[model samples]
Target chain A: MLEFTFSVILENLLLATRWTILLSLIAFVLGGVVGLIVLFARVSHSRALRTLTIGYIELFQGTPLLMQLFLFFFGVALLGVEVSPWVAASLALTFWTSAFLAEIWRGCVEAIPKGQWEASESLAMTYTEQMRHVILPQALRIAVAPTVGFSVQVIKGTALASVIGFVELTKAGTMLNNATFRPFLVYTLVALIYFALCFPLSWYSKRLEGRLNVAR
Target chain B: MLYQMNFGDLLPYWQVLARGLLFTVVLTLVSTVAGIFVGTAGAWARTFGPKWAGTCVSIYVELIRNTPFIVQLFFIFFGLPAIGVKMGEAEAAFLAMTINLGAYSTEIIRAGIQAVPYGHLEAGSSLAMSRWEIFRHIVLKQAFMKVYPALSSQIVIVMLGSAVVSQISAEDLTYAANYIQSRNFRAFEVYLVVTGIYLALAIALRALLRGIARAVFPKG
Candidate 1:
């Protein structure tokens, strides 16, 4: 067996970390765009649209993300389209993240008193205009801290993309472990990298939450 | 060949799926109970125990919270044996789930404990209740009332997360699905059915928890 140096292992792991970061960015941006649409439907005036969005959110939220990832990986292929692991993982995480972000933003939107909505209505504003001028701007402020906090979840979530054979941080750890047989050192480094990525966002979220509460 | 969805192929594997469903439910239950026990203790330590203990608990919570559950499960199952500690796949999954949920519930329960009014503690003290007695009757009871909904939601989340244990060869619901797919080459159908079962399970678990809460805290 060939000898493996510690620095060699670290170097390989760091290279894979780039994919993890990139995948997270892709999922977050796409999920945010989709989540905004889900939010509109979730809080819309039409009862049918509201009900449809609720079911959509519940389906994603109530199931394990691993299952969702698996479904996308295989389900997409079953459609007679050639599916890459990268494409499947991105699609699955986008849906999953959007479900959560929509729910979180809904709470912020609902937190705005009914009076605000009524005031906008009395001003002869259309529904879109009311939301545009009155509700979302206010909700956006409260949404910021929690949205930032949930991004930590989004980052941690990218780790699951590895299950579909995406070559990200966690997958890289397993690959290195197979080569080096240093499960302890390898997994520890993997956890440390995740911690480094996540702790700052969590800390910032909490600080933002505290400041928001004080302002209220 | 164009893929045609064929869920009928899974009918013969009903027993396998049933066993997997049972295993997943059992795992969720065992971990939830054990996890809450650990959480209650950790919460107490964080709230009223020594400074060193509180600091240790804080570190533990942050460490567990920041990482993915899959990584935590992988570390326990694959990493610990490197140091002479060993366990069966099921046991490792159980331990990982318990520890993961414990860290979360500790934070949740501590917030509940903090929400109790200072006056309630004084009232219990005037009644000649010991500290432990006050905690059990006055503080914890009220705290539970305040945080029960949040705690219930966390339990459901953990139960859903239990799906990943299949990766380690523990025969949970997802494991059965994987096994059937490997045997019959019906990955799509098998996963679809298993995913449905999971959705039903999530709904049922939430309802069951809510029912228990109603019975235990009728006024709340």
Candidate 2:
């Protein structure tokens, strides 16, 4: 039987940490872009657009990320096009993140008092102008905390991308565990790396939430 | 190249899909019920128990909340066996899900408990109500009413999150789809079917929860 050594595992685990962070960044940025568009559609006055956006959100949020990964991974291949796992993982996370981000943002927009919208309209502002000059500023303040908070979810969610063969932290841990035959030690390190990545965000989110509450 | 989409290849796999859907529903119901009790208890401990108890609850909530469900599943399924507590994949998956949902539901229920106003408790006390009576009649009732929407949403999320258990080969909806895809090589069609079923399940679960809420808390 092969004995386990923490030092070797720690080194590889640390190296894998970078991929996790990178994946999270890509997911967050892309999700944010898609989420912004979804948010616009969700809150638009056009009933069809609003309904369509709601359907999109429900489809993404209602299913598991694991399923989404499988769909993207194999779905693309079934189309007679081979896509890299990185592309598939990114696409999957982007959609997942957008659904959540859109919801969070819609809540923030709705949190702005109705008076603000009316006030902007009274000033003869176009819909876009009203949103840009009036509603968005206030909504942005309300959104900051929750958006930051939701990022923690997105980061944790990136771990699921590993299921489709994306070589990130959890997958690295799995490989190390297979080689080391040290499930407990390997996973503990994995959990700790995750904790190190996630705790600061959690704490920061709480702090931002507290500040927002006080400001409100 | 415009590849032909052959959804017809999946026609024979209806039984597999049906079985997967059934497993998904069963897993969701089991975990949701288990989660509610665990969440309520944790909320109670944080609200009415000692300082250490609250701290412990907070730790549990934060740890579970921040980590991916996949890792938790692996920990329960693979990690526990190493410690000599061997369990089948389904049991481990259920245990993991219960723990994960319990932590989240704890926060939601705790918020509900806090939302119960102080005046109600004082009124119950002045009316010669015992602590248990006050909790049961006033605190618990009001909390449930206040947190109905949140609790309902959490249940839906838990139901969806149950798909993660397919990783451990739990034979849930995703697992079934995976099996069918491997057999038929119609990956996209299998997933499309799985997605539709999941969307329907989510809607049904939400509607069911809403009906229950109306029955339990009419004014809410």
Candidate 3:
């Protein structure tokens, strides 16, 4: 057995941090696109589409993400497809992030007064026209801060991917602890690294929120 | 090969599942009650207590809020033992959940406390209410009334997050699912059923909280 030093463990954790960042990026960007579709469906003029979207959002929001990861990991294997932890974690996280982002953006869009929709409609604008020319642009402004704030959640969420053996920062921390037998030092560093990644985003989001409130 | 869904295989483990569900519920109930108390005190410190206490509370909130709950659990369960602060898995899970929820609810409750109108404090003062009396009777109740929905949602989120506690061998609903899957090789069915239970639990918990809100805050 080779000796495990503090520096060796730290170096390994730093390398694993890359995956955490990449997974967060993949989930956030993809979830944003899918969440936009869900948002549109949620706000669509058709009641059926709106209802279906609500169920979609509710299903994702209500269930635990850890279980979702398990379903994607072990559940997909039942279908004869070999799923890697990376693929399963990404897929599960994308869907989970989409659900939450959709809900958050829905709140933002709904925050627009009803009169804007009516006024745009009276101008002979169609639904798409109103959304493109009127509502979404305004909603996008309010959506920015909370959307950024939610990315902290997405980053924290990738920690669950470790449970599925995704080898992210948390996974690396556990492995190093196993190797080094220094759970206290290893996990503390893991937490501080997560906090370092997350705290700036959280601070920035709060500042943005403050500025938004003042602008109002 | 198409996978056959056999929930019947899980029928034999009904007791295991039920026990797990009961444990999860009990854990949530205990931690939530305790967490809210911590949150209220933390909120009071942040809003009305001394400066050092407020800063300390703010640090605690941010540190917990910024990190993931699982890491916190690992730290308490796996790491704390190194410093001679040992505990069982369930105890560690309970403590971590309470700390996590306390941080979140502190922020939530502080917002509510701050939103309490200055005029209400004046009214309480005019009524000859003591400082503690004003906070207890006027400020705290109104703050809770204002943020009750947000608090309930946070509670539900904490409950859902509690699934991770199973990782520490806490034997939550997720642990039961994992255990059954290991025995019967019914991963898909087990997870699907567990996920459904979680969804049902989330919905029922929300409804229960709503009922409590209605009973507790009759005007709201």
Candidate 4:
């Protein structure tokens, strides 16, 4: 009942890339905001906040994103609230990204020399002021390259949103495979598009990492 | 209005859950064994083997690292069938996990290999150690000692990632959850319970791996 043409398949997949791109952007921007809060909580002197942030990071890092997506997708409906795959996916990925980004940023923060903290403290800067004026600026510099590097991971992660019926690139591949019965052509195109999106970012991440290594 | 939660319904699926956990453990153990071998060899080749070998390893690393694991699994399980390379679900899942872990550990292991101080290698050479002997006793051992923590984390990652293998109906932990939920119409309870199990497994697995690392490198 359906014909599988190369042009037709490519067009459909190209259209699907829009959703993938949008999901990645949504997850990344929102995750960054949440991650910064988490990072601050982690680095602060409050023991309770530190433990809470550690749990947040470990819980997200320990579980598979796929399971998180499943819980979000189904867990909401149990509360008599209806949720689309879009909302659930965004929520799950945002939290997942926060956990990872927070840990990454914390590492960069801790990597700063101890003397910087001492100097800031001696200047009578308040807790927030010390972090804001002194520590964060230097930490932000170290954070940039790794932050960019992790975006590639975020992009690859959007592919999993398809598992919850979000209809991104991987889901599009499955749909096309069903329609065309051409797994090789459809999946190869799918992998190629993913490669095109990811390789440049990975290469850039590596370059930045090299630069960071040289600086250190 | 809040709905009352019921986890009691999941109690009837203990056997299925146990089977799934066993399967996950087996898959991760096998993959870790094979994956580390692939990584060690790839690292060795990149470090000492020919230029073409290094290129092959680099390409392999980037390709696997850049793509999503689910896509890699699908390509192996679904797409490979088109090329007349048919594999059972379990076999395909195993191969995919091994390959995925291999690519990641290659980079991890390579970093370890690089961390071996040059003087140590020279010291081995001074002792009249053969190439294989130097690599086996000095380079590989020290590399493992230096990078075991990172390698253990990666292994746990691969273990958690094995959850995706259930998509191909490999009957791992997630599959057990899927089945239990379907049977009881208690998706939320089933998944939450299964998530707890996974968390426990990850903690325990990390501890176990650390124990092994301690044994392997007593000085460490």
Candidate 5:
């Protein structure tokens, strides 16, 4: 058995952080786009669309993300398409992130008073126009803190993508542990690296939350 | 050859699946009860304990809250053995989830504690109540009442996260799904079915927790 050197484990672990960062960025950005569409559909006038969007949100949020990743990996393969673990992981994380983001955004939207909706309606603004002009701007302010808060969740979630074999930080830790036979050192370092990535975001969210409350 | 779906092959394995579900529920329940005790204590330390105790509690909560639950489980299951501390998979899973939920509930319970009015504590003091009596009789119930809904949600999230322990071969619900899929060569169907089960489990767990919350803290 190879005795593990601190530098070697640290070096490999640092190198893998790039995958974690990139995966989080891709999932968050794409999920935000999808989440925005889901948010609009959820708050739409059409009863069917609202209910369908709610179901979509609940379906993703109510289950383990690991299961979703498994489904996408095998579901794509079943459709006769070549599916990479990277693609499967991304798709799973994206949907999971989108569902959460939609719910968070909806909470913010609901914080807006009914008067704003009627004001826009009285001005003959379309539903799209009202959201774009009157409601979203105000909701966006309330949305900022929770949106940032949810990003921490999304980032930590990338860890699960490792299970689908996307080779991010968590996977890197496992590989290092296997190679070095230093489970304690390697896993401790992995948890620390994640803590380093996550703590600042959590702090920022807390700070934003405080500021948002003060302004209100 | 085309891909075929067969959930039928899994039907006979219902006993195995039942075992997995039992383990998951048992783990969730054990951790939840112990974890809440830890959280309530941690919250007390933060509120009324000495300065050092509060600092230590802060560090514990932040560290656990920041890291993913899977890593926490892996460290307990895989890492501790390196230190000559042996633990079975179930033991490790229980410890990990207890720590994870403990940190979260510390925050929730602390919020509940803070929301207790200063006047009430003073009123208790004027009535010659001991700190313990005041905490147990006055603060605890009110805190539970205020934060019970939030606590209910956290319990469900923890139950859902219990799925990850299956990675360490703890034979949780997800592990059963993996096992059935591998044996039957029906991965998608198995996962889909398991996903539905987990979703239902989350809903059921939330409802159960909410019911408990209502029973524990009567309307004031």
Candidate 6:
């Protein structure tokens, strides 16, 4: 039986932590871009566009992120396209994160009162101009705390990419556990590393939420 | 090259898919009920118990909240056996789901409990009710009604989360998909079908929860 040492495992785990952060960043940025488009579509004057956006959000949000990852990874292969696990994982995470971030942002946009839109219109601002100049700036304040909070979800979600054979933090932990025969110790370190990555965002989110509430 | 899709190849496995769907529903229902109770109790403790007790509950909630459910399942299923507690895949999955749901619901329920009007508790006290009686009659019921929407949404999220138990080989919908994919080699079609089913199930579950809310709290 192979025995595990805390020092050896901890060092490896910390090194693997970089991949987790990298994945989270890729997922967040790509998801943010997609979410912006969805948010715009949702708020657009066209009913068809709005309904289509709603469908996209519901489909992504209503399903588990894990299943989504599987579908992307395995489903793409069935289409005779050779895609890497990294590409598949990123695509799935981007879609999942976009759905959630779009919803969060939609709420923020709508929270800006009708009067603001009306005032901007009265000033003869076009829809795009109003959105860019008048409305989004206000909505961005409401969006900040929740956006930061959602990043924690995004970070934790990177773990699911492991199941698809993406070698991130959780996958590394699993590999090390099998090699060292130390499931508990390896997973505890895995959990703690995730905590280290996530807890600060959670704290900052809470702080921002408090500040936002005070401003309101 | 786009492969010609044949969902018909998956037709024979409908029975497996049905059984998996049933298990998913049953697992979700049991866990959501159990989770609500656990969450309510945890919220109560956090709100009314000693400082240390509240702090401990806070820690528990934070730990579960920040970690992935897949990791939690593996820890329970694989790690617990080393300590001599052996549970079947389904049981361990349910236990983990309960713990995971409890942590999330605790935060939601705490917000609901705190939102209860102070006047209601005072009114109960003036009626000479005991503390538990006041809590049960006034605080709990009102808090539940206020948080019903958020709580129901959380339940849907939990139900969707149940799909992850397939990782530990629990015979849920995703497991059925895996089986059908392996058998037919129609991985894409099987998943597409399963995704549609999950979407329908989620909508149906939300409608069911809304119906229950109407029946339970008409005023709400």
Q: After superposition, how far is residue A37 of candidate 1 from its true place, in Å?
A: 0.3
lDDT leader = 3
Q: Candidate 1: lDDT of B105? A: 94
Q: Determine the TM-score of chain B of model 4.
A: 0.98
Instruction: Give Cα distance to truth, residue A198, candidate 5, Å.
Output: 0.6
Alpha-carbon error at B31 in model 6, in Å?
0.5
Off by over 4 Å in 6: A1-4
Model 4, A107-194: lDDT tens digits are: 9999999999999899898889988999889999888888988998899899989988999999999999998888988888898888
Off by over 4 Å in 2: A1-4
B1-220, model 1: which lDDT tens digit per residue? Answer: 8777888889999999999999999999999999999998999999988999999999999999999998999899889999989999999999999999999999999999999989999999999999999999988888888888888899999999998899899999999999999999999888888889999999999999989988899672
lDDT of 2 by residue, B39-144 (tens): 9889988998789999999999988888888888888787777888899988987798899889999999999999998999999999999988988889988898
Error of 1 at A91 (Å): 0.3
Query: Comparing to the true complex, what docking class would candidate 4 get?
Result: medium
Listed models, DockQ each: 0.78, 0.69, 0.89, 0.78, 0.79, 0.68
Better of 1 and 2 by lDDT: 1
In Å, residue A113's CA in model 2 sits off its true spot by 2.4
Candidate closer to the true structure by DockQ (higher is better), 3 or 5: 3
Q: List the residue pairs that clash in candidate 6.
A: none
- Superposed on the true interface residues, model 1 gives a C-alpha RMSD in angstroms of 1.1
Clashes of 4: 0
In model 2, state the lDDT of residue A113.
90
- What candidate 1 gets wrong by more than 4 Å, as runs, is none
Better of 1 and 6 by TM-score: 1
Candidate 3 local lDDT, residue B117:
95
B46-148: candidate 6 lDDT, tens digit per residue? 9866788889999999999888888888888877787778999999989999999999999998898899889988998999999899888788898898888
Please, what are the lDDT tens digits per residue for candidate 3 over residues B1-220? 6777888999999999999999999999999999999999999999999999999999999999999999999999999999899999999999999999999999999999999999999999999999999999999999999999899999999999999999999999999999999999988899999999999999999999999988888773
Which lDDT tens digits does candidate 5 get at residues B172-209?
Answer: 99999889887888889888988988999998998888
